[model samples]
Target: MGGKQQHDIRHSDRTPAALGYSMPPEWAPHEATWLAWPHLASDWPGKLDTIRWVYTEIVRKLVPGERIHLMVRNAAEEARARQYLHRAGCPLSRVLFFHHPTNRSWTRDSGPIFVTRSQRPHPRAIVQFHFNGWAKYPNWRRDRQVPEAAARHLGMPLFEAFWNGRPFVLEGGAVDVNGSGSLLTTEECLLHPEIQVRNPGFSRRDYEAALQAHLGVRNVLWLKSGIVGDDTHGHVDDLARFVNRNTIVMVRESNPRDPNYRRLEENWELVPDLRLEDGSRPQVIALPMPAPITFDGYRLPASYANFYIGNAAVLVPTFNDPKDRLALGILGELFPDRPVVGIHAVDLVLGLGTLHCLTQQQPA
Candidate 1:
């Protein structure tokens, strides 16, 4: 592994017409699931121990099925994480931690976007992009520089973009691809000019062009909003997710009084009965949203859409509400090969997020 500052992963020698970089499916062989060790007690408040247990349980479910690539900031956190994994009886060999520093444990949104080629074997590279704390959380300078460290540690090449010689803003949560060209995202989060500070030269077109070049995305489907109380404004992950090339499971609200009922209904109508580049409308399914979990009168973002699909099992966030079982049943049907396990996210959401918000999966 070698250290290089802001290494560009894209080779300028090839044109988009000449280059053949298609986004591989999520189920493609994963080297390991990437994660950041939790440290900030401020995010968990008094129940940090319970949060660790839940996170440890997540590793327990995933490590048996596949490898776990974790990120630890310091020696103490690393030791603790190692202890938790050991006690959980996870395969020690499969759990490897890199000393990459991060501001928080949400590696999925902040970590490197690792994409691979389907034709090639064991080819893993990282995509380095700019993260501005969703333009909400202002203290994430260290978090923004994660890709450089990840590239050096893994000895992989980096792909940095320069469309219009201007920077682009995108989060891992804001976009989900079906391994084909079509992608699912929210216009509220990605295109909100007032919500984000963009480079003077880059427009929405510039951003889409960059996506085409970097992630191999083609047809971009724009959704309206995510579940309310989400801090990232409205990341698509909390509203919709692509489980396979031709199937997507979305979160829906049934009660009229619920704040998300109308927004969720509109999103349902917006979901296309259309096809992919392969010409097949994705099988659309619905997973009901759990009862709004609140702390001190303020509602926390609670949705079944925040499930993290791992190699072996899908770790879904449960609110201990009635909808928990229904959500798991739906997810289980979507991922028949993998077991659907639920984690009580009632306490977790007090931090303004759930499972999907906490963990990021690294594709093999």
Candidate 2:
């Protein structure tokens, strides 16, 4: 029956896994990085101007190694972004703008997930998972159009993620892959039936099957929870990330009295026990958490684990805390070949995310 079932599933031959395609890790070579220009005033409220400057700086740093495919609301917004990029001395030749309108600036969640296969008439394709504004916010109708827009722009074939003949809702930030066959995610994010309820009736086995069928992952490592202030409930990108195929960098809090201490500690405890598909344990590194960042009595999710790995550099978010330098130094040692650049994210976190939450890489 197992053999027959496998043959029956392979008869369709439409899934990424069926075609030998897989989502590569961030450290892999990339064709470009995708970002949505910050336009909606409601997202950052009074800090839109400052956030625009932040976006410009991020573009300046990224243009040296690879192209940046930026999205704008319209022609006017594109012209404004062009002016800012010119002033920031960005390499205009390396940046391309798309007129795709987005409800928010977080392209990491709404952007296309590019997958690649070795042999091909088509080596590049996109997995368009349904986005529902993290299951909390509204005004996401425009945001939902981003993945299809990106696929059309690249002229790549689109594969929609579905289960039981229903569209499956998933945010890219909820999971991290090692480019091999292992995936890292949080139970609090994907398995909680009531809270953020991505797929209401999906169980742990259901999620594992879906991941294996679409992302080509063989092992699913689950962390118990995330930090205290993450609005998405528990995104693995904010708690832990794979720095390399065999190494993981997880956030650790030393102060027991802090609100995030217990939860982060529990997640860290699961690290040593995790093994890859080869039955080998990965080397776990402890990255220090910055002092809590707050704005208007609200705790912002300021985390060092939210760093984005680009083709030529790793952009680490710094919160003006004392541990910022410490985290940079540690990452520098870990990634000797790539430069570790820190971006001041104190203001950026006011939107409840940092570097990794804003950009998505396109594999070269």
Instruction: Candidate 1: count the clashes.
Output: 5
Question: TM-score per candidate, in order?
Answer: 0.92, 0.96
Q: How much lDDT does each candidate structure score?
A: 0.76, 0.88
Measured on C-alpha atoms, candidate 1 has an lDDT of 0.76
lDDT of 1 at 360: 62
Residue 93, candidate 1: how far off, in angstroms?
2.4
Q: Ten consecutive residues with minimal summed lDDT in candidate 1?
A: 1-10
Q: Candidate 2 on 1-364: residue-level lDDT in tens?
A: 2444333432344788888888899999998999999987776769999999999989988888899999998899999999999999998899999898888988888888888889875687778788999998887889988887777677776778887777778898999999998899999999987998988899899899888878888999999998888999999999899988988899999999999999988887787789986889988899999998887888889999999999889999999889999999989998998999999999899999989999999999
| Model 2 misplaced regions, further than 4 Å | 1-13
Look at candidate 2 and tell me the lDDT of residue 361. Answer: 95
- How does model 2 score by TM-score? 0.96
Q: Whose TM-score is greatest here?
A: 2
Candidate with the greatest lDDT versus the true structure: 2
Per-model C-alpha RMSD: 2.5, 4.6
